[model samples]
Target: MKKILFLTFAALLMVVSCKKDPLDQTPDGKITLEEVFTDKDRTEAYLSTAYSRIPDYFWKYSFFAFLAGITDEAKDSDVGNNAGNIASFWNTGSLSLSTNPLEAYGGQGKGISRYVTYWSGIRDCNVFLANIPKASVANEDYRKRFTAEAKVLRSFYYLELIKQFGGMPIVDKPFEVTFDYASLKRPTFQECVNFIVKNCDEAIAEPQFPLRITLETERGRFTKAVAYAIKSQALLYNASPLWNPTNDVAKWTASANASKEAIAALAATGQFALHPNYGNYFLNQSDLSPSPGDKETIFEINEASNGTFSVINSIPSKPGMFKAGSCPSQELVDAYDMQINPIAGGVAGEPAILGYSDADHLQPIINNSGPGPASGYARARPYVGRDPRFYATVWFNGAQYDNINGAIHTIETFQGGADQLIKNPPNRANTHTGYYLRKFIDPRIQSNQPHNSRWKKYRLAEIYLNLAEAENEANGPTAAAYAAVNVVRNRSQMPNLPVGLDKDQFRVRVRRERRVEFAMEEHRFWDVRRWKILDQTDKVVTGMEIIKDPITGAFTYNRFVTERRNAWTDKYLIFPIPLGEASIIPDFDLHQNPGW
Candidate 1:
């Protein structure tokens, strides 16, 4: 009986030992957000999550949505004959709420989207802001600066959301797991803009925050200048015809003032200026320097480490080329004005108002008009004597494309030659427009080498154009506006606007200037939409059909309408809210844009 009692006591002891301990039950690898915020390193890494979510159209995810294709600027290689390619689908206006492209699922897949949803990014920003005070960063000033920067980021995400969807539910706090999604309602357009402005103001109010970043280590972070720039852009969009249908002159004045303020802030830094080479600027020539800052880039998506492979996608479809995507349109080519006699008051022979004609596009008829000291162009070369930017931006049939590693070869976009429909059939890898983009190309890039180029999100030139547009609208082409535009013109070796242009004439000049200066940089598509001129611009897309004679070796260029079916419509002014979200909401029409 004593032995049995001892065995029972041992069994009871084993049971007590095996009982669940609270410490043992805790998860090993998991960490609470509070723990994340309290640690300096963890908190900083957490802040980077917000930065990482910025829409990267140039890189891995949405490379095919080259904005040039959908606009008059250029045409993408016929990526799809059917409605399978995402870029083609986007260009064709086949978007639906159920099949929204908010993710990075490119092509006909399920991952790439057009960046319409940013709630997760917004949540990240809110989390950072709410928990930052709890972080134990020893540098008190830095903590304050970081807080202000977080505010700017929050504002930026809102700006992105508003620009795409007009307005969104302004969720300033992180939603709990049990939070009701159905109750969320999008704010008013004006309310959304005000919220963004308020965020900018909060960031600007921080005395410790700097106007520009001088440290190379912190290149892509938000700055006081960037905040102001965002404000300027948001205000400008608010004043634009699409959003401001009532023609509110006050909004224009506000936008002009905001832009001027941004310029003043940038100029105060004494580091910002126009880079001498417009073409080389986008190629990240500034990175070649050991210095921290670039004069041209106010804000940019920096890709210094891996470098961008956009060159590979954009290269002509020759034997050694990667893919003949991003083909420049004949319409964009024709927009480049051929240099003629720039007489003192106005161009000679042409009307004072109209700059150049089709005859100007041809070789000079006479010795005076033709290639000489007087005419500036040669007869054999049809592409010569155009704007200096034209040579930098386009690679035509006869132009020598420098392959830095080997001998320079003439780009053959003629019939039976390299990179033409006659020699290469029309497909995703072939050029539909018989022209290739030369802008943002690194001539030094060889087969094995990679290109590390900067993609400008905002720059001095764009700000100058913004200032000119806003000032022109507010004060009718004031001296400040003229000087602002002249800054961009002189940089590109183009002539200044003719001396006596009326408001309408000045407006036309400004619009054309914007088109040529910002071509293939993703501005034309949005510019048309905001200007309420998409109907005119998006009516038809054109391409150049080059017929080359085998015996004579002569080239005949004919322009033809390549893609029809007006992609522009009233519904497209603002993209529809993702249908997945709309269907779940009560009174779906109230939550969605008109007609899905």
Candidate 2:
């Protein structure tokens, strides 16, 4: 049943092969645009081709591993002699314009060759918009809405480009095959922002475009809310230090207003709100958000095909199970607060796990409860009393795995344990950081049940965070700013930011909140870059090694720097345009990024 559902969705997304020829042109056997517009099905299919090209956050073709490998969020353990070995790249920081995984183009082959340039995707959107008027779809309203969807999607593609490469060429309309490549010059960063905002406005102005889609079958389709979310995100990026380096307060004001507009539009629909359980929101279980009323997720990539290997790859390679991939680093695990003392009845003598200390974060030395006999802290059981999200997101050494099969199993990531480095095969199994991601791995997956793990692109929680950051920057931590961030904190059961925090203090809180909230969701990699703090945050990747005593059966934990984090510079802020594209252009306008 799930397979059929996947197939139907995939059909709507109509996958197209990568363009073999550099110059965009109609294929010899391809039907003309007039013929396509004359038939409703063919026209819709043409638009679906662009939809299929929407950048997938967790594309299974890339081994279901993400940019998290390089960031502090997690470490990948796909260490082998194969062509796809990037474990060293993440730690070494040796990525170049020709070999960076973030801008990988060409085709979706195995390993690092999994991203698209999106130039062809944007071209397809332009063609669709140009030819949509002639479509005899019977419903004028549907055609208008379809055109709006194309426009929003095109703007989103541009957002993806600008976020990574800064200013980019603004190609609004389709050009002739004879158009000169050297004539193209990237517009200013502000110009690119204006282009995206203008496209979003055009989409929203369309009368047929619905603010929110009410149908379950079309849950993942673009809507007015999606456009607003994109606008809010783009504006927020524009307000960031990377773009607004002068600390322009007006940019912050613009970003705050855009975010408020998104929140207002979503609130008016009464169809969107924060999901109560932050942890279960990622899982496909119906408890948190049943179909038709899923209020939290603003935008998601509904997988268009079956046979996704990401789930299996993420599953820990047990005695005879799947290969382990994407090991969450200790750096991420330490970010979760230790809520409860491992000892019962709040008794003392147990080592305190108050979370990372201000002095030395790598070591867990803070005593949440001041030195006392009633404190229930325990060093061996540090997972207790942490945020609810910690359990849902990280699979630590002693964490329980009750979601799998019918019985409960304790995850043993300790030395020589079930998921430990030595226990599993060294070549293709085991975790590099003695941790695994539990957020998106469905428990019923091993039972062969349908798993609906989705990569949520935008959610209300993110908007709340965006509002908090922007509001504080613009208004110096007002009540409204506190309220926005408190919404997310309250949902996760974490305490709100202390009252009377100055603007700079609140700003620091907001940044840390983003890291904890969106840990493994692929947000940190860009957030640090945009904030221009690569020198401080991207210094080193660390992992935890546990040594178990055979006689006493006790475990000793040690934190050590991993080999993947070596060199970094300010030049890594924006990815270099692929050498393939830059080399072909004869003009200085298309030069590679500095220090490429």
Candidate 3:
């Protein structure tokens, strides 16, 4: 009898152990939400979550925000901060970057570590999603909605992951410490692409995918359109030379097919359309309000309206560049088409307004154009008729820029220190990439002045680029693709671009437009990588000033700024997998990308 009783107790203890780990159980007879969600609702949170997180460097420092800005072929200045020390990420060691620059080189300390923390975001989605079925939400409808939520979150994570680490493990189950991550090997590019595709599809199918009825429908939520955009973007990424397995033509075809499908899915939902006016691409005239106004923005992550909300890494230090980081590279500027060949400007013979200028840059292009606002006013002309978006994005000499209020705008009449002539000035753009980012910021945002500012993580322009590039690469031009690309320019108030542009020429033009349009948004470096054109990166950095002499009635080189040094190395391409991750795996054979 005693032996039988002990056996029964042991059995009961085992049952308790299994059931006691419940996430939603309450002490009372009633089940709590935690228990209910553990049994079910977890997926709801997963399906809808925002993408903005502040790491150490960019949260308060704001220097790191411009990581994207520097990647483009744009120009940036220190304004009056950090002795013009900004401009290193894009111009170093062959204009290339090693995977470990933050660790091995720049000693960016917490920066890289902070960046990888986003993985926790991925992991959180994973854990929450894996447990959704384990929970039992009281409402059946809630349960179904939660399931969709998890998928959307999963898709969002994959989008960010592939961009950084090429292909990674697509974990579906809760990870046990015993889980053999070491034994895990990186999957082929196609595998990664496929996983992303599946997640995107699932996210769209989500019955509860964000429905945009209010101002904040986008606040902390993922929508069906967002998923399709990512899917399209991923395929476009795959079709690029970097991932397409050049030897395998089959992969290219697959990538093209993926893009077409993505577009169709988006269209099928009838959720997204182009935002119309191009001038609204950046945060608009209102200091207190900014909306892409149903035209320029399709989907975007919400940064806080309180200018203090997201410490903007994308913006240069307001009045003075406090952080000596993220200036520009001259090679990026050289990429602009001649004035008559404005690509983004949306019209032919669009005046190409470049930033190069000589010491005496005040000279005028047309003798009557007269001396620049100041002698040696670095200005590029044939600048008119160019894509309106281009002007909105870059801060150029001789162009008027608006103060945050929208009423008080100023044309960049003189270089940061040209009028002051302070040799010992602490903060100013000194390196080759002299221009600074103007596109992604609120023009109303003043230097170092505290005001509510908002930044976008996604937008319609990217969608159009994704569509145009994918369509062009896949089936050639469709009226929709051309219209999509053209709208960005037209709305920017650029002249109308002629149709019938060929793939090769139009593709390069598109590439340059993306570079400038998204300058400092940090897409260029990766875009170049995906396209397999790291070799095109120049090792040195410099800038030019468009000089026209009113007196001579002719164009002359008074000489623009030059880096007078080399800043790039080859290893800057693919970042090395974290050394720690490789150290545990046997035969880790993971070769670091060149320059590190």
Candidate 4:
């Protein structure tokens, strides 16, 4: 009976794959579904298909597409008409219902890459769950584990959808062609959150689910930690200002509890902690696996060694490198705090301890205002005495780069310098913002040698930040909240946030911490949206212009607006459902988001 059922399942998958319709789930009668599940390999292969839609964030052209380009963090250098340059589409405010680069319903060729859509992933999960019990595998434990993994993946898909599209259709089972697509209605925001959280809970309860993946072969598979991470993230989004407009403390409290629980669960395993070296965590090849290797990484997408990042985002003057992709913005550079202590012979608080003179960042907070000899941050030497992460993340005008051929080169982005931005001929490979990204690009990687890269999807530091933000929002700047934020700050050798801060003041500190800590890891794009602060952050991005006076050998600094963005409206808080999906059935009432 089991063998017959498995073949029937295989036949269903064959039919499903052949259909062009995004909503098509009807099984054609060509092959038996039982035949597919009867064979252990086939059954496992079906499960693998569900995992294929997980976003390859490390890939430059995938979902979010090096998201820094669209946010205040950075700007993409690809200004041409390249179809794969999705960031350009966003920077120009070209995203519409009919033409969204970030749409998730349709598959690869339709608009975005094959890995961007989540609806198809959810469908695959539903199909696998409904048919997995009929498989003839000898180990029941394996069957249970597979089922749990599907549930978590489905929940994760929903989480991704909600992050971009707000509430979505809650389709839990495979539908037949005869199923009435017009009858489907989008659920309420809270309803959607509840459903995703419920699915995560179900996956976590499965006895076979490992808290932290220890086996090398099963490295990327969903574990109890992944499920908890999803739950915590969903709750945090729910409690955000965009969703919780009422400023409800209860929502924040719930989010705090969920995050606290996730932290405790991971702690109980004793398998996760902050990776020792803040700069090396992102580029370290030896610590790619979960256990006994960077325990801070709760989930990561491992990729083969490739110099694609180096070729695209490296300094334009470097050999075999092209465009300085996603150049770090001056706004981002200003976020890194100045070192607190003063230089020799300077009073403790005489010099400016902050990075910027004002919140607008129009002027730098200079050290030794009268300027006998600089003690802290001086506008003339703006990069001095900044946070350590600043050194790890940005390649400024005077930064040194070690070449693969055993030579050290000093990067010069000043006017008329070798790496200076070209305007008349417009060298797209040059840095537009006077700084190149140094966070993810491994210095050892040349055009010939690719470095193994891993995108940390869910790290222990993020969990700590989530907890800190939620706890602060719920109960003010409590001791627990400070502790959470300090753990992340201390890892970078930065001083702790000052004590006795008011709630509003602490809020600013938390947001600034996230901006600098996650710099180009794709957090700023979503962080601003969730906090409802896009109008402030997405309006204008600035860049620095350094001029060298050859006669006196003095350098002058100037700030200029790199680009004026067009997509900071409240309507942009959540994306519009793709027109095709929104109007699939005339009366389906999928309900496009307001102001689309």
Candidate 5:
């Protein structure tokens, strides 16, 4: 823990005064903070490095893993090394506050990569901001704009900390090497909110919030509205009970107003809007534009036509896209409403488990000659017939799973053919999530195809969810929540829900709608945390299974779920400060969360 913190602090320090290195320069070379910011190329490179450090593969911090697996968004019956534990704890809503297996909590070795890297960017930006004016060179405006951007990134990290662990320290500038650990104390939650808002103010006061398109140069880095959106998001979370369990009405109201102001201001920029089709939102490497009539997008961090084709890295690395991902959870599946509605078909009303005879052939019903169910299922009948997002989010039995061949493969509990997990492997092997994920990755993109397959880091969908949560809290949202939800729903060709529903009911629907709408985009776990609903759900280890009859007769009541199993606990929510760090800091509390 000390080593990690030490590294974090050291990184911050370097960010303070390090100068930019030329592209041809060695990775390890000395440049004071002054020498670096003077050069535009160097400045861009330094900031890009900050973004680059956001950890790839994300076996743990990958936004999707935690979002889908750690909340009630998804669950799997079979187990795998990393996936099952994520699914299990979330589905059960029973995670303990121990060292989170997800490593989502801050630590020396393990942590949200974005947390560390983004902070480093902030530190670097601070160094530039402080030194740019004093630089022997000119272009003061350029240096300050970059400095403003650093503030935006730093604020972004604080937002992450707030969402994951409530209140935390705000370190805007790089500290001297002599900064004392004993002096570091978490600020009041209000302080954190104010700090972020202040940063947003600085960002907005400057020429851009989300770069006014006019400033074309302010493209991806923090723009004026991006700051507002982020502040809005942060204040909204602050208003949430997770940050104020006691219902501090004043804090809640302030946060709502702050966020509302941001929303209105950002809308005024006239740069953002809703993308038409939800299906188009998931970019198929084959096509660049989104699906038709799906234009409800607001602000999005686009990965389109960008990167080294790294977005689809989660798919198996060899055949389709990459071997990095494909982890889906049944917990996620149950959340999607059957095309009909979340209330009617999705999990809200369905039985938790089902009973079936091993002899009952699902293939005959599904148009395949496959065996049937097991004698019994452990829990309750799984939920079904829900929202359209469910179909968009997962692959169920008889569902068409896309890939190179581009055929819809039926979802079945492992009827077991060797290599079924393979694309050409005749049999189907389910992912640890109990179902297959279909949101971010498009299976059709192949090495031979003229496309780049990868996950989108940001999209219009998340903003919609954010608006739903924020607007619902600020005002009894009628069109706000409905518009937000419809923005995403219509993307997938679904009908819009009626507007002006009850606040409580609308809140529930939107939350679930986000789960299905942005399944693998990595929103579920954080959504549950912000909504303060993790306590109400299960947190057990869930996994994948063959669901075969153990009896294995020609036809009998014999079926079983089989796969490597994993577990999650209550402590998993607020990651414990790794054991090593707790030992060194006398003031630090080892108050590991309950289940740890």
Candidate 6:
């Protein structure tokens, strides 16, 4: 019989009011906390439960549902068609405190229940930390390491919470059933950031915690690097414009220092660096492996082998495919830097040569616009001479794509083509943006084959970018900041930023670099929110409308609005607190976000 540890506390009842599964019952159908901690296996099982709340970015039910769809980066095909699609809730502006699709308060759902499950996970961590010392079989070293892991996990949960809901009620311990839950209050955003940083520091200082996890068995466990990564990311978010509206240089300096410390700590081990091949880094299974795998990956969630990702995101013309999932927006495609400047007489290696002519990304900067030498960009042939990352990320009209059976097929997204957007009858399964997602879809995974896909939560490139942004904001684009951002650009074979950019110009470059570098990686969703640029970005998403001439075989490209999102208001800067939690508690101190 399978045994289970149950924390029947009134605090838990306030959030997760569901009943336990009968299959998870013990032989006697009940196991107490004392009975659980006395046994090493049960104690370890309890700790494992705490790790279960980490958001799975690949699945449709979790935060992934809204990450790409609600942003200007892509338009999710699943919206408006798929029942219970969470992205639709945010897309149509139908989301309310009571009607939150992402909230899994009952704890009987598939995806990561952002609010209730995370709180439950935090409670589990608290219980494990308080009782692990009582485990008879675990030695002192084992107990210490386990305690540090729980602490790091707790901090991680808090970080995720703050990213979505701003400040949250700090719950450090597992309260009893009789404890007054109404007495809890939300702390200030800075206080929450400090608390998370403190927990991370505590975990890092633990003597039992290894600098890096070298053993295959301990691959996903918390390490000193993971702790540092959590610290760096939290500090970076806190220093962002949304949180630090005064543009505090001290906050930026602190974020930069944290990122610098993280980079130095990892560099000391000499095991972490950027992967050479950008495309193969996501496709190759070996690159996603632990330790001996891609050294760039600081922390990743290894998901079960499932081949549906390729079919779901591929063009509808592909055999055995379902629908095009997140179609890359024309705005996103225009963010890639051109190989040569779009202006005449502009040579190779010159910096700031982006493809678009304006901030709205409506006009393409074509070759030979002026009198001198050609810029290498052509209006008709838009795909040629662009950044290499563009090819790795989006499947354009003429791009060659591999099928499940290892067959090469060219995707044709032009009007009347096989992958065209069929809107006459409104076939929502087609690509709305004239492009399909090419990143993170394994070409080798056949229909019957199962392949393990890893979602990188924290990587070395992000830390470098974080350092660059923080430094640029703190000290107005210093040489150190240039070197950091240039490392990431050089790795992708793109030229470095120009030498004479001021603070504001360098800031624009950093944001653009992040948009292209981390496209579709769940970064764009939060980056815009943190930067407080959602009003400009999320207002309208554009797509390419390619019309092919029947007689001359010439192509005409036009930009059209794929979606005009309604949730771009300032209130959307942060998600509203779930209705149940906000309304159920009479004296609940969790105030709703503005304009909610």
* lDDT assessment of candidate 4: 0.75
lDDT of 2: 0.68
Candidate 2, residue 189: CA error in Å?
1.9
lDDT of 5 by residue, 290-311 (tens): 2323223323343333332333
Local error of candidate 4 at residue 558 (angstroms): 0.6
For lDDT, candidate 1 versus 4, the one ahead is 4
Q: Candidate 2, 332: how far from true, in Å?
A: 0.7
Q: What TM-score does candidate 2 get on C-alpha atoms?
A: 0.84
Q: Residue by residue across 247-289, what tens digits does model 6's lDDT show?
A: 8889999999999988888864687888888887876533433
In candidate 2, what are the lDDT values of residues 267-299, reduced to their tens digit?
Answer: 546768888778778775222223444687778
Which candidate, 2 or 3, has the higher TM-score?
2
lDDT of 1 at 75: 68
Q: After superposition, how far is residue 369 of candidate 2 from its true place, in Å?
A: 9.7
Per-candidate local distance difference test = 0.66, 0.68, 0.47, 0.75, 0.48, 0.75
Best by TM-score: 6
* Ranking of all predicted structures according to TM-score, beginning with the best and ending with the worst: 6, 4, 2, 1, 3, 5
- Model 4 regions lying over 4 Å from their true place: 1-30, 62-65, 80-84, 102-116, 285-291, 343-361, 364-375, 423-426, 585-590
Per-residue lDDT over 1-596 for candidate 3, one digit per residue giving the tens place of the 0 to 100 score: 22212331111111121333443233354653344355333334333332332222312222333454234353334333432223433344322222333322332223344325545556556555555666656675655555665665566666666676566655654444224444556676578778878877776676765533234433445556566666767777777776775635455455556545654555345444455544454453212113323533444433334443222322232344333234444445444433233233233422233332442222223211232111111234433433455465555444555553345444332334321111244244332244444454555565544533245455556766776676666556667557656655554554434566776756765676677556656577678777766554433334443344556744333234343223323344455555554454433336433444
For candidate 4, the TM-score is 0.88
lDDT per residue as tens, model 4, 199-306: 989988999888887777786888888998998889888999988999899989988888888888886567788888888888854353445757888788765445
Better of 1 and 4 by TM-score: 4
Q: Candidate 6 has which clashing residue pairs, if any? A: none
